[model samples]
Target: MKLVSFRASGADRLGIVFPENKVADAQQWGAANGMDVPDSMLGLIDKGLEFRDSMSAKVKATAVDDNADYVYDYEAVKILAPMPKPARNIWGIGLNYTEHVAESARSLDTDNKLPQECIIFSKPTNTVIATGEAIKHNGNQTQQMDWEGELAVILGKGGFRVKAEDAMDLVYGYSIINDISARDNRRQGQWIVSKGMDTYAPMGPVLITPDEIEDPHNLQIITKVNGVEKQNGNTKNMLFRIPEIIQDISSVMSVDPADIIATGTPAGVGAGRDPQEWMWPGDEVEIIIEGIGSLKNPIVDDTY
Candidate 1:
């Protein structure tokens, strides 16, 4: 089932997309009537993996039920990040692609080159933005801004010291993550602050179940700025796969359900070009991954 978090009335709610992409409110329907699981995607995962599976099945089955309580057209509502406020830190891998690594070498001082081991960073919870939201393009603080299109993994079960072989079992589903970056701030210091800017992490349209994607790492990740194609690559070039990343991180800390893992962006970023170009105000950025829907946002003049 393809799930989404959307705004209805004045609040955010959980929903499932039906045959034609119609929205079905999982929570409101459960409250007014009854449900097998909680409304929020995070809540359903907290209930355990079995609960997620059962609820997903029920959501699919309810599509044909004449008494279905709540159903709305796809365009009738605003799409929010599948998990508005995830419980754990958002972990992101950097320089996992050879070309991206090579670009970093050219842009950074010798001392700032890629580490021998996996290079990991974190994005705060507040950085998470819903699909169709505006990304600030102000030039006051940062002179250069860029985009990275990557496949993001959302965890379903909590686990620490997980084996690489068993890592896939903890995943809830997949979503496209636009790792918006501030090139200036990033080159100045670490990514926690630069890449963690408000609305820097725009994710979603829908969270597709793993069953829908036979091979998560086999999809294409493409990005465009103002209708001009800028980045085109596939997950096949990843140096560290999903299972290896999970194992690498889990060995140190527990990965809670809903904690996002931005597997790493593919090559072809703006910084990788001979003459670097960055996003400016009035520019539109669109990120699309196979099987998952596209995430589009306009870059506005950010006063902040």
Candidate 2:
């Protein structure tokens, strides 16, 4: 099921997106149909599987019923991040792809050596944004704005010292994130400052539940800028997959429900290119993941 957080009629509500672009408003439908449901994506995630399974069944049944009253126009509702307000910082793994590592090395004139383990980073919760939201172009602060399209994981259960083999059991679903970065900050080794700008992390048009995606590893991830394809890669290229990522992080910090893990990006980021193409006002950045969906955001100058 493709779960979503959306605002309709000025109120935020949880939605289940069915094929054909139809969305069922959980809060409204549950109220009208006498079925209780969570009003937010975070609420749903915390409610556990029984609740989600029941809600999914309700969403599916009510979607196909011509007499159902809660189906709304997908285009009319404004989409938000899977968890519009994250409970904590979004965890990220850096240099987890070989090609990306090589490109990054070449760009920074560093050794073209891949990390033996995942390089982790974090994005402030405030950085999160949704599809169609404008990526704040900090034209004044820094001119080297870049985009890193990555596959993000949402955890269902909180855990510490989790095992790699058991990682999938704790995962809730998956979404797309544009890990926008300021290359200048990165050049100075200020990762958080470079990648944590508010609205820089453009994510979600749809959040597909784990059941819908049979295999996350084989999915194709593509990023395009203003209609020109820039990054093209498959998740299979990831040097550190989901299992290892979960094990690596959970060993140090407790992973919580609604926590977002951005499994490193692939090659072809602007900073890694020959001419180092950067995003400017009026440019559109789009990240397309195989099973999930497209997250497209326009760049708007947020300069003083």
Q: Quick one: best TM-score, which candidate?
A: 2
* Model 2: per-residue Cα lDDT over 252-272, one tens digit each: 988988889999899999989
Which candidate wins on lDDT? 2
Give one digit per residue, the lDDT tens place, for model 1 in 34-137. 66547687887777777667766766566443345477777888899888887766899988887788877787432345556667899888778888888887
TM-score of each: 0.93, 0.95
> What pairs collide in candidate 2?
none
For every model in order, what is the number of clashing pairs? 0, 0
Q: Candidate 1: TM-score?
A: 0.93
Candidate 1 local lDDT, residue 70: 71
- In TM-score terms, candidate 2 sits at 0.95
